[model samples]
Target: MEENHRLQVIEEGPYADPGRYRRLVGRLVYLTVTCPDLTYVIHILAQFLKKPQVKHWEAALRVVHYLKGCPGQGILLTANTDLTLSSYCDADYQTCPRTRRSLSGYVILLGGSPIAWKIKKQKTVSLSSAEAEYRAMRYTTGELKWEHELLSYFGVRHDTAIPLFCDNQAALHIAANPFFHERTKHIDADCHFVRDALKAGLIATFKIHTSNQVADIFTKSLGGPPFSYLLRKLGIRDLHALT
Candidate 1:
């Protein structure tokens, strides 16, 4: 296995070639199937593949190094868990330096294990953090519905509303209050799917503090300590402990 630092190429180069870089990124995308930790990093690196400069290659290599250090890390599912379904969602409002589009990410858990997750750039640029988060909640609700249906196929049933945790109090308030139309009139209609779901009793939204926002891991980069903390909270355990 390669060390984390060794994976990065420090030397500067204009290396305008993209063929090799594309192949490398393609391989990384394939690895994301069983290695969810690399999904965000790999998605970010894939954006720079068209003009593969030294910086882009260095970032991709860093992911390779990180993977090498924790090759045994992966999600684990246990038997005899509860039927409770819950999710955490978040967004980085206008985080894209170029287009200013927000990035939406969420993780859905069945009992104690994460069964589905996603991280993607929003289709539209949101005017405020509250709006961005609301949009993310909508996307997450759509995913939750799909998961609910899939579980039904297997005879697993959840009678109660699926709870979605969001760190933004303002967003949670907006979803719960129907009279806040004056404030939210500017937001896209599609982004209001969460509110509609709330009305139908399909899902429930709750406010969570920043410290407990597990979905933060998918939306932005974090220092080693906080990152590891959330990873463990998501049910990712050290391979040695399981053995």
Candidate 2:
């Protein structure tokens, strides 16, 4: 999907074949297991499966065209022994025009190799960008906690606080600060789940510049150069590409 493009519910416009669109999106869902880059786009297209518009189908086909260009492009799991877990979490505030909901995403890496990721629409509308980002952090923290426990099962223990990177300073403050503020009064208590995790030393929130935020690729559409740059940062590669 292009950065400028936004998919929405088109009620009056010409619609596409629903069956075809659903099938394509269904297959794309499977591709996401190995193609983390396609996760966001597929998540967006899947929302319109029941009543897809022409624009939606076109976007789906565009994804197919992109896959054809580099069918072998995929994540590169390194052989390095470093088992540290790090994560990047982000949100696109009010990205859904119809519902005014935000898009949240996170990528979890194990020793520079992506082990898990997720892109989801917030269940409730967030009044502020900080709230949206904080919600995303909470989600990422839950997954991070689960992954942390799972590693212990495999006899891999991390004694230090795992880093959770975010571009929003306000959200980080919310997690680190124990007191509530006027602006954050409306945010649900559960949204501060990351704060508890922080107190327990399960994770540490770090400020990352938006430009270096690799999770941006999972939250919103981006232009070509930055997209490729982040893809490389994600440890994705095309080993079979012709020289």
**Predicted model with the maximum TM-score:** 2
State TM-scores per candidate. 0.90, 0.95
RMSD of each: 3.9, 1.5
Residues 10-99 of candidate 2: C-alpha lDDT, one tens digit per residue: 555656468988888999999999889999999899988878888888899999999999878998888874899999999999999999
Number of clashing residue pairs in every model? 0, 0
lDDT of model 1 at residue 170?
Answer: 83
Off by over 4 Å in 1: 1-13, 241-243
- Candidate 2 ranges beyond 4 A from true positions: 9-12
Model 1 lDDT at residue 202? 77
- Candidate 1 per-residue lDDT over residues 168-205, each given as its tens digit: 98888888776656658767474467778887777988
